[model samples]
Target: MTTAERATELRRLHAAPELLQVVNVWDVVSATAVAALPGTRALATAGHSIAATFGYPDGEQIPLHLMLDMVGRIVRAVDVPVSADLDAGFGDAGETVRRAIGQGVAGANIEDQLKPLDEAVAAVSAAVAAADAEGVPFALNARTDAFVRGRDRSLDTNIADAIERGRAFLDAGATSVFVPGMFGEDVVARLVDGIGDRKVTLIGLPGVPAPARLQELGVARLSYGPTTQRVALGALQDLATSLYDGGVLPEGIRPLN
Candidate 1:
């Protein structure tokens, strides 16, 4: 599909511009399960999900090759679009961008945690340039670490930093920027307000609001990083145990084919 058409399709299904919902699928089964859900239009890989399934935490543990293989399977399993959750982009800025584009992915989450801010900006910028050079519509959801560690950035300071990062990313041709782990309606309102008209798409998550709530705040995207992973586990656990424990199985529940 054309980039503009693809981008527009991504938007209309999402409804809030860059505001898209993502499910962390660790395997093909998970991908298939989520693809059946009607509210979702895209799939996002969780580095943590890959690492955890491989007996590691989310901290730069999973090999990029392994991650890419899983990403490939997710793409194969569903007809919808897929984005790689490349933690810290997995390399220097340029390589990060290059690898993602090389993978035939539509978008990625590149963070600034593992490097200094200036370096991170350069990397993100190069990645964006790479996307442009490839002539593909790639989305880069820039992840800032300043707010994650609770390093004392007030709402305004955080907003200012995000706007600066957002501007740089947009200039680099990034499709959008994701600010994770932030909450509170007022804070979200301020970020959208502060970035008025610059128009770099904004995404926040792990605590993104419901559709109605996010629409009211003017957020362009809402991604639920690992939330679905956690809940799905809870769901199957609840289901399997309910029958075993004689906990209110509904009518026609005993068809063991």
Candidate 2:
């Protein structure tokens, strides 16, 4: 399918009755793995994972061109729709989104942090408009960092702030609102209730219930972020340690046939 078609499909997946579970990938290998999964419907990139693979850090530390190249490679590798987590849009949200659309990204998660709320809204709106101009049904997942940045504030205040930003993002043409670092059943429920009809996206957190439980709590989507990469790296660390100690190789490691 064309990227436009893929974008349309991704939007439908998010708006569908069933929950949208995205396994964040960094490269073609990971993207191919996720695409081959039985239940996988689409793909997303974890900025931190992609950056780390290139020996950089997340938070826009990687160059935009390099990130776009990585995303383009993944898009070329997978048949399923792919979404990119373009952290702060590499200092130019609109331009970054234009490049992403050109690279065949069906959707993206753009975080609203390190910028004023109104400015962020305008940037997000520009992305939405750009997608429209290109005739791609792009799914714009606008993220707010209130929970992480405002933890010192009261819960009610944080919820209110989230709701405010979420509403603004939705109004600005974002397909979904992501409140990362917002976990717990009660907290998730509150976000769902407070956000009303708009789709609420939650980042996966340790000890949090599975997607089944999250769906039960009214979450529209769940993403693993960089946790999958961390797990894979951790396993590699254990393997190297065992090898250094002259211990038996791990079960999963085997010479190519």
Candidate 3:
């Protein structure tokens, strides 16, 4: 599909009745491996994973060009739509997303990083406006770090902040508001009710509710962030340990790439 069509398809997936589950991938091999799965509908790039793969720390430490280069390669490697994690937009949300659209990325996650409400909303608007200028129905998963960044604050405060930021982001034209962090069913329900049904996205962490329960609670999407990459690396580490202990290669390993 063309980039625009992919963008539209991504939006449709978010609005679909079934909750969208996007496996986060960092490079061409990982992206292709996940995309080959029968149930995979789309892919979301994990900025932290990509940064770690490139020997850099997270939080836009990796050069924007390098991240986009990898993201573009992944886009070319798979037919499914890709939603890149363009961390905090690398300082210029609008231009960053504009460049990503040029890379054929259909969607992206831009974190507010707990910036001031007005500033965060402006960033969301800028990203959406940039996508509009490019004529792509880009899915902007506007993220608020209220829960992640506001750990010292009370849960009530964080939830209120998230709902406020989420509504503002939606008004500014974001496709969905990503509230990353673990939460109980009650918290999830409150967020969905406050932010509008099927308008909230979440990260699927170890203790998070199951996808079925999240779907029943009205989450639009669930994405596994750096955990997926960490799991893959953990397997490699175990294999290395086994090899050192004189273990032979495992049988029936299929070539995915």
Candidate 4:
């Protein structure tokens, strides 16, 4: 399928009856590994994982050019649709979103963590316009940091604010409303109910409800944001530790081919 076709498919997955489980990847190897899975419908990049793999910090600390290069490689390596966590659209929302579309990404997670509400809405609006110009139905997952940044405030306020931001983003043409740092079923359900029309996405945080439960709560999408990468890195650390402690590698560790 063409890039635009895949983009449309990705958008459909978000609104499908079943939950869209997205396993985030960092490089070509990881992308290929996940794409090899029989049930994998799409691929997504974890911003922190991509940054740390290149020895940089997350939160847009990685250079835009370098990030785009890596994402381009991943998109080329897989036939499945690829989405990237383009943190804050890498400074220029419209231009960077266009760059991602050029790389053939089906979707992206654009965060509004540090920017004001109006600016964030404008950014998402710009991304949708850019995608239209490119003739791709880019799945713009507009992420709100209300729950993460509003810990000091009351829970009710955080949930309310998230719904408000999500409504604004959806009105601005976002494909979905991504509310990270929200794990509770009640809050998740509330957000889903409040953010009408568009699909709702939640981060796959540890100890959160199972996929079935999340689906019951009306979450259309769930993504492991950096958790999979951190776990993989931990495994690498363990392998190195075992090698240092003993001369032999683990019994199950062997070449795939």
Per TM-score, the best of the predicted structures is: 3
Clashing pairs in 4: none
lDDT per residue as tens, model 2, 50-106: 999999977888988999999999999989999999987777787788899999999
TM-score of 1: 0.81
Q: What ordering of candidates by TM-score runs from best to worst?
A: 3, 4, 2, 1
In order of listing, the candidates' clash counts read 4, 0, 0, 0
For candidate 3, the per-residue lDDT at 132 reads: 100
TM-score of each: 0.81, 0.95, 0.99, 0.96
Per-model CA lDDT versus the true structure: 0.66, 0.87, 0.96, 0.88
Candidate 3 global lDDT: 0.96
Name the runs in model 3 displaced over 4 angstroms: none
Compose the digit string of candidate 3's lDDT tens values, residues 105-221.
999999999999999999999999999999999999999999999999999999999999999999999999999988888899999999999999999986789999999999999
Question: How does residue 119 of candidate 2 score in lDDT?
Answer: 88
Best-fitting candidate, scored by lDDT: 3
lDDT of 4 at 231: 89
* Candidates arranged by lDDT, highest first: 3, 4, 2, 1
Flag the better candidate by lDDT, 2 or 4: 4
